[model samples]
Target: MSSNSSIKCTVKKPVEVKISDTKSSLCSGLSIVDLSFPNNSEKGIQQIESISFKNAYTAFLTIKVKSEQNSSSTGGKWKMCLHRYQLMTSPHYESGSQDYFKIPSSQMLFVPQDVVSVRLILQQPSSAWNQFGIEQVSIETPTENTNEEEAISKWLQQHLNLNSTVKKKIENVEVDEVSGGLHRMWALTETVKAQQTSASLGRYEVDDSYEINLLSYT
Candidate 1:
């Protein structure tokens, strides 16, 4: 008797979410117009859903950075973003879907400890992408006592100290960029306030997070 091999659907198929970059409220950054902001009382974290995007294919993600701006005239300054995320286990990185982001290394003293939040605007309009899945995102805590390497590191040390340089350079291992075949990136800007643009950032998970490899037939 002859036996035949069978195809397995249990190959851990990607958690398909059919993300329409244009239909969701994922334009340049945080706005008082759309996005259902989740309660951010858990320290400093928030999750929003039902964000619409006109740049469907170019539809990236964004993080609304709500800086504690005082007064109504100068209230919370909102900026959206994307961050370079590295899994504790995996070496691959998660980042913007554009070309290259002029992201400053974590070593800058002037940049706040919370400037990772950026607006995710796409160069194209109303597009769709195969977002595998995001597991968890949480607020980054400031750590203490990290050693320095380059001359700039010493400069930061002289100005602010070891922690300053440590905070700047997260890790320099060039991970797989998302802008080539299956990825892209956006232009880096510091508009502070603008009418149109987009960006992205990470959201901490309540529990565990995992990374998985994905392939798209579409």
Candidate 2:
């Protein structure tokens, strides 16, 4: 896989997405933000993944982070962990509060303090919101205690199912460079974790065990 440091961050700043006033067809839109910001601020794109349900649409928010060796940064320790932020959709109020689509799990892992990315995926196959638009999206950096591996691990263990035949390994960590010297991000990979890979890299994960959560702020 290719690696690079980027300027991206999870936008803690929340924005509003207007909800439909009347009954609309099932449709989904996509939203994304810069995951790598402040530190190694680089703009990246967020792509859409399949939805969990046929009736429900799905979108994604993404940020880019490189290894410390990839870029330069002063943040230490909790540099690589999940960061938290809120996303507010609904230009108008949905019962006084803007409609919020929550990521089943909050806090994306490994996003640097300053640099993060966010993206949205629209799954309105019914074309109800072919022109869906989010009025505003806000983002900000999380605090020092954002890392919640124990909680996340517990959650994963409870939700994730382990397989006996899956071969997993913890690969060596590689540090890459950001677009500029603005900030640094951490990129980590494990055999247990599943993502797309090239034929040259071998094949996709054979096990269907654990899952991960990620998002970006606007």
Candidate 3:
């Protein structure tokens, strides 16, 4: 893939977020946030690249995903991608509160292909804060262009590896002495020009009047 290409999938706006039941007495407790993707035909099937969100006194987080199955008989099922992941170093304190975090591709248990929905189970044991929940949640998926570029890159790398001897021969070829001498001369001229200082006209007067009070010699 190209270095500049992003693997994150473009999440459509108006993401439906459903919050589960919370404790009435406590300010914050266990809660579930479900994110649904209604339209799959627009961008086609996509895999989960990463998950990102801003922390709002959330101590722990659990991630589950649902993906479309190939078989028509069997429908999509929910699978646990991440379980009881610690979001904050200390829930009681404000160490990880209001901090933005991104769960990288490597950390994910399994990359769910054709993912239709995602569930985030948040837990905040501490009641020190007035409100606690995850904020600004985002789901990233690999782009079609990224996948195509990755395939092309892999093919090119394989071909290059197979033709390593040709590359070595090109690198080993010596430069012509005439061209080398010209390059050296150009470099020398440039170096001399850089080192040369502006010549003084020996005149320190502005309007035929000397402005210096003391003579300076170095």
Clashing residue pair totals per candidate (backbone < 3 A): 53, 78, 1
TM-score of 1: 0.24
Give the alpha carbon lDDT tens digit for every residue of 176-215 in model 2. 4333332422233343345656545313323443223211
Identify the leading candidate in terms of lDDT.
3
**Best-to-worst ranking by TM-score:** 3, 2, 1
Question: Considering summed lDDT, which 10 consecutive residues are worst modelled in model 2?
Answer: 47-56
Q: How close is candidate 3 to the true structure, as a TM-score?
A: 0.53
Whose TM-score is higher: candidate 2's or candidate 3's?
3
| lDDT of each residue in 1-218, candidate 3, tens digit only | 42222333333332223344664432337777777664563343477677788998889988887766632335655788898889889989988888999896669787677766677888888767656778777766665455776789889778878999976876676779667998999999999999988965446655556656523532
| lDDT tens digits by residue: candidate 1, 51-104 | 222221222333344433311244646544333222112212223332222223
Give the CA lDDT, 0 to 100, for residue 62 in model 3: 88
Give me the displacement of residue 37 in model 3, in angstroms.
1.5
* lDDT, model 2, position 119: 36
Better of 1 and 3 by lDDT: 3
Q: What RMSD, rounded to one decimal, does every model reach?
A: 34.0, 29.3, 12.7
lDDT ranking, best first: 3, 2, 1
